[model samples]
Every structure is written in C-alpha cells, then in structure tokens.
Target: MHSIATPKLTASMLALALLLAGCATSPDFGETLETRSEQASAIAGDYKKGEKLIEAGRKDVREGRKLARKGENRVNRGEDRIREGEAMMAAARAAYCRDTGYATPECR
Candidate 1:
C-alpha cells in the first residue's frame, strides 16, 4: 500500500512540474524594446537637431491649438491661428531637413 502511494505522489509531482514550466513566458517577446534605430537610419538623420526642432515645433502647435480653442474674439483667434501655422511650418522644416539634409528658404 505504501509503495502504491509513492508512485502516485511521484506522478503528481511530475505533472505539477510540467504545468509550472508551461507558465513561463518566452524571453524578450514579453517586452517592447522601442528602438528608433531602424527608423533613424532610414531618415537622412542630422539626428539631434532635427529631433529637437520637431519637438519644439509640436509643442508650439499644441499651445496654439489650446489658445485658439479659448479665444473669444476674431483678433485673438487670428493670433492663435497664425501661431499654429508657424508651428506647422517649423515642423515641416524639421521633417524636410531630416529627409533631405537641408531646409528650403521658405521653410526656414
């Protein structure tokens, strides 16, 4: 009777071990390594300058949009719209430089 119980316990332990193994996830597939490396290389990449300008320009756009939304008069609304346009121009300039390595005079 003791021997029969020993075999049953051994079989249950093996089954539990297999089940625990199944719970383990594949390594690195669980994580998102958002490397911009490939995208950076694909672009003409003056890298730091282009990225910085884009960030600044995008911030300007967001601020201008917020201002436009708050504006009650035509004058205030016009000013905000002008700001948004300028921001878009700057962002375009940055993208052009990133793609072509130079900005057009108008973009500048």
Candidate 2:
C-alpha cells in the first residue's frame, strides 16, 4: 500500500514540474510575430528603395558616358578642321612663292 502511494505522489510531482516548465517557455503568438513581420516588411521596403537609387545612379552614369563621347567627338572634329586649315595655308603659301618668283621663308 505504501509503495502505491509513493508512486502516485512521485507521478504527480513530475507532472507539475513539466507543466511549470512548459509555461515558462511558452511563446507569445500575437505581438511577437506581428512585430517581427513589421520589421521584415520595413526591411523589404528599404531594399526596394536602395534598388531604385542604384538604378537612378546607373542611368546618370549612362548619360554621363554619352556626354563624354559627344565631347570627344567635338574635339576630334575640331582637330580635323585645324589640320585641314593648315594644309590649305601651306598650299596658298606655295602658290604665292611660285607666282611672285620671290621665295619667302614660309615656302621652305
């Protein structure tokens, strides 16, 4: 009889200990998950904003490249014009030297 009573008391004590342990570690299912969800959404929004900024920066870079290429083309054209003008001047100097029969220093 005493042995049966001892086993029952032990079983009850074990059950009570497990119950308290479970209660101590129970999760808060509402506010904790809600707060975490909000945080996740905010992070996603920030990520999207960052992507937009990066796209804008890339567009600006492309525009800058186009402008630089245009400027380079203008410089090349200016150089070509200068070379053409120099050639014309040389031809005119040669003609003047031959027509006047006076060899000028520019003809050499």
Candidate 3:
C-alpha cells in the first residue's frame, strides 16, 4: 500500500473523514438563540396582557362602587318616604278615633 499511496494522502483522507463526521449535524447555536428570544418575547406579551386585565378589573371595581353609592342613596330616600307615609297614616287614625270616640274603621 505504501507503494501506491503516500503518507500525506492518507493524512488528507483522515482529515476529510473527521471533518465530514463532525459537520454531519446542522449548526444549532444560532437556532438555539432564536428560539430563546421567541420564548422571551412570548413571556413579555403574556405579562402585558395580564397587566391590562388587572387594569380592567380595577375599572370595573370603581364602577361597582359608584353603583353601590347610588343604591344606598336610593334606599335612604325610600326609607324617608316610608316614614312620612307612616306619620300621615297615624295622624289620620288619631283624628278618626277622636271624632268617633272608639275604634274607627281605619284602626280596624
């Protein structure tokens, strides 16, 4: 074999085989960085969406407070109206009893 081939050619063939075996797989360093950046961007987007939803919930709570205040005012007004009607009915009943000198139809 040494008669036909030189040592230099044997060395060159070994180097080529080694290079080809080492490079069989595609380069992954650039692809790994790109995939990590995409994951980071997605995480950032999710964080922003969560913040916006929290803001919307805060706005809804403020609106609910406003509605509760309005409801309380309406209830207070209704209570005052009921008190006035009860006082008027009592006065009318008293007047009827005084004139009849006994239990009146209104008292019954």
Candidate 4:
C-alpha cells in the first residue's frame, strides 16, 4: 500500500510541475504592459491633434461668418445709397422741368 501511494504522489507532483512550466512559457506580463502603454500614448497624441484641428476649424467658421456678415452689411449700405441717389435724381428732374417752363427734354 505504501509503495502504491508513493507512486501516486510522485505522479501528482510531476503533473503539477508540468502545469507550472506551461504557465511560465506564456508571454511576459511586463512586455505586454509596455506594448499596451505605447499604444495608449499614441492614441492620446492623435486625440490631442484631432482636438486642435477641430478648434482651428471652429475658428475658421467663426471668421467666415464674420466676413459674410460684413459683406452683407456693405451690400445693404450700397442698396441704401442707390435708393437715395434715385430720390435725388427724381427731385432734380422735377425741379428742372419746373424751372424750364416744361420745355426740358425730360418733361417733353
């Protein structure tokens, strides 16, 4: 009985040893951690660059809107000036017709 138990114990010990050896052959945890750390840093850098680009794009949009508003204001002013000029021309034509005793080419 003692001999049989001894053999069984040795076999169990050998199996445990084999399992531990198999575990040791796996990839190193430190190296895997280092690789993951590098990937994270690269992702962070790209994220920062993307943020800067987005901010620049927002600034450009703001500037474009400002320029468009300025142009629209200029167009409005020009239209106003044209209306004023037309009013003046009409007044001048009327005055000329009255002063010329209706002999002006415009009155005729």
Using lDDT, rank the candidates from best to worst.
Answer: 4, 2, 3, 1
**Candidate 1, which segments miss by more than 4 Å at Cα?**
1-72, 103-108
Q: Put down candidate 2 lDDT per residue, 1-108, tens digits, no spaces.
A: 457545643333544544454445547535354454455455556666776898999999999999999999999999999999999998998789898786667655
Worst 10 residues of 4 by lDDT: 8-17
* Candidate 3, superposed: residue stretches over 4 Å from native: 1-31, 105-108
Candidate 3 similarity to native, TM-score = 0.61
Better of 3 and 4 by TM-score: 3
How does model 2 score by TM-score? 0.51
- lDDT (Cα atoms) of all candidates against the true structure: 0.59, 0.69, 0.69, 0.71
User: Is candidate 1 or 3 superior in TM-score?
Assistant: 3
Error of 1 at 34 (Å): 99
Q: Residue 62 lDDT in model 1?
A: 100
What tens digits encode model 1's per-residue C-alpha lDDT throughout 3-106?
A: 85456433334444433443344244443222222333333234445667989999999999988777747788788999999999989878987777565565
Quote the positional error of residue 1 for candidate 1 in Å.
99
Q: What is the lDDT of residue 32 in candidate 1?
A: 29
Each candidate structure's TM-score, on Cα atoms with residue i matched to residue i, is 0.29, 0.51, 0.61, 0.56
Candidate 4: lDDT of 89?
Answer: 98
